[model samples]
Each structure stands twice: as structure tokens, then as C-alpha cells.
Target: MSPLIELRGVTKSYGDHTVLRGIDLEVAAHEVISLIGASGCGKSTLLRCVNGLETIDGGEIAVDGDVVSGPGVDLVRLRRQVGMVFQSYNLFPHMTVLQNAVLAPVKTGLCSKEEAEERAMAMLGRVGLADRAGSYPDQMSGGQQQRAAIARTMLMSPRILLLDEITSALDPELVIEVLNIVQDLAESGMTMLLTTHEMGFAREISGRVCFLHGGGILEQGPPAQIFDDPAEQRTRDFLRKVSLAGRL
Candidate 1:
């Protein structure tokens, strides 16, 4: 069977600066892949490209064999299949957590309000946030807010999830709570593509780990090979820096 997601010679740029240069990747069903690199190495950009948030400058990106990065793509339908969570919890400040989670499904006519609420509540419970369903965004902690955002995305029943530094905005002590939710999703066989700074968690959770450099994949392998026995000198250098910073 074909991969669930595929990118072939994908390229992206802003003005004169290229963010992704001829990247080729494939994500199989139920696989969890982690993208690790220095800041601005194009990990987040790649995710955006896949979800049709940013148009690619060259090559192709396909989800379930349907081209999504080029012209004439049905972006709204594409987004329904691809859920993304960012570092910032972009929850509506005035909306209650449950309201925020259910809005998309209701607005898109994907489900009735009652149905949306039921799914929203169940997803909130899954993320350990059912108790906070009636709370506003400002009333919750960063971790709680992020978890609510995850619940909101999950309510859409997306085929794949893209997480972009989801824990980077939280306090150190609060990061684990959010990571635990993601860990649970991984164990439940979610197809995920994540860009993360948490190397240890990536090593522990990812089925495959990719090292990105200069807008390209410098190396990729199982977590053990990428973390413990990297092949490329650039990969080793990056890991060494992460180690010195006590982040690996």
C-alpha cells in the first residue's frame, strides 16, 4: 500500500531565502515521525506546507494520494483531514473550552451541534480536560490550554496530526502534562508528524527521527540510530550541541 502522506522534491522559500530545499519524505499509516533541527531549519514550514497552510514553491505534497500543496487543491477538505497544533494555544479567549472544541465541527457542517458537543466532551476527557470544559482560555494554565487545543483538533477526527513545538511555550514543569497526552495518542496508533525541541521525548516516542539541516534532511533513522549512532557529521555536531545544552 502507498504511504498515507508523501512529499517529493518539495521546495519552499520566502523572498530569497529558501526554507525547504527538495525535501522528500513519506509517512506510513499509524507511524509517528519526529523532525528535529536547530531553530529555523524549516520543520514547522514543512508541516504548514503539508496541511496546505503555506503553498510550496516547487515539487509536490500528497495526503492519501491526493495532491494538496499545489493549485486547485481543496484546502478546506484537506484541513479537515490534517490537524495541526502549534506552540501558541490559539483558543478563542471568550469561548469556553467545550465551545472552542466544538465550533469547527459545527461550523463546517461536519456534525450537528449535539453530536459535536458529545465528541468534544469525549476528546476533552481524553486529554484530561473534561473538568475544564466550561472554563475560558485565560482561566486555564498553559498546559491545560494546549491540551484543550489538542482536544479541539481531535474533535475533527483528523487522519493525521501535525504538532509544531507544542510544548515550547509552556513552563518546564507543565511540559510533561501535555507530552503525556501526545504519548497516549502515539500509543493509540495515531499518524503524527511533529517538530519538537524535546529530544529525549522524541527519542522515546518517535517511530522514526529525522535530522533536518539547511532546509534538507541531513539524516534520518530509527530513534536509536539517529540519537545514539548518527551517520552524518552534521547530525553528530547537532546532537553534541543539544547534549551540551543538556537538552538531549
Candidate 2:
């Protein structure tokens, strides 16, 4: 079967600063891939490009064999197939958790309000936030809010999920709850591309770990190999720094 997502010579730039340069990657069905690198290494930009949140300067990105990077693409359709959750929870402060979760599906006419609410409730339950459904964002902890954000995205039933540092904004104590939800999603066969600072979690949950450097994937392999025995010098150096910082 063809890959669920593919990037061929994908490139992205902001004026003279290129974030992603000729990035080629393929994500198979049900595979979990994690991108790990220092800041400014293009991990987030690559995820943005995949979901059409950022336009590429060169090459192509395809989801299920349809090009989504170029002009005339149906962005609405593309986004529906690829759900993204960013570092910020992005929930409406005034809306209850249930309302926040169901807003997109209802507004997009993907389902009736009743159906959206039902699905939203079910997703909230899956994320362990069923009781918080009636609570507002400010009433919940950072972890709860992020899980609600995940639930909101999952309600779309996208073919793939893009997570760009979804736990970055949370307190250290709250990070594990969000990671556990992601781990559960992985176990349930969700195809995902994530950029995370949590090395141990990435090592445990990702089937393949990619080390991005200087606007490209410097190295990629099974987590054991990539983390324990990287073939590239840059990969080793990056891991050493992470380890020294008590992050690995």
C-alpha cells in the first residue's frame, strides 16, 4: 500500500532563511514517527507544511497520493484528513470543554449538533476528561486543557495527526497526562507525526525517531538505534546535549 503521507524534496523558507530543505519522508499506515531536534531545526515547520498551514517553496507533500502543498489544493479537505494540535491549547475561554470539542465539527457541517456533542463527549471520555466536559478552560489544569484539545482534534477522525510540541506549554507535572493520552492514541493505531522535547517518551512511543538538523533529516532509524547508537555525528552531539540538560 502507498504511504499515508509522503514528502518529496519538500522545502520551506521564510525569505532567505530556509526552515526545511529537501525533506523526504514517508509515513505508513498506523506508524508513529517522532521528530527530535534542537530549536530552529525545522521540525514544527515540516509539520505545518504537511497540514498546509505553511506553503512550501519547492517540492511536494502528498496525503494518500494527492498533492496538498501546491496551489489549487482543497485546504479544507486536506485539513479534514490531517488534524493538527499545537503547543497552545487554543480553546475558547468562554466555551465549556464540550463546546470547544464540538465546535469544529458543528461549524464545518460535518455532523448535526447532537451528533457532534455525542462524539465530543465520547472523545472527552477517551481522553479522561468526561467530567470536565462542562468545565471551562480556566477551571481545568493545563493537562486537562491539552487533552481536551487532543479530543477536539480527534473528533475530526483525521487520517493522520500532527502534534507540534503539544506538551510544551504545560507544567512539568502536567506533561505526563498529555503524554499518556498520546501513548494511548498510538496504542490504538493512530498514525502520527510529532515533534517533542520529551526524549524518553519519544523513545518509548515512536516506532521510528528522526533527528532533524540544519533543515533536513540528518538521521532516522528505529528508536533504539537512533537514541542508543546513532550513526551520525550530529545525532550523537544532539543527544549528548539533551542528556546533559537532563532531557534524555
Best by lDDT: 1
Candidate 2's residue-wise lDDT over 86-183, tens digit each?
A: 99989999999999998989889899999999999889989999989999999999999899999999998998999999878988889889889999
CA RMSD, predictions in order: 0.8, 0.8
Question: What's the lDDT for all of these models?
Answer: 0.94, 0.93
User: After aligning candidate 2 to the native by TM-score, how far in Å is the CA of 38 from where it should be?
Assistant: 0.9
Off by over 4 Å in 1: none
lDDT of 2 at 219: 97
Model 1 CA lDDT for position 172 = 84
Query: What's model 1's lDDT at 138?
Result: 96
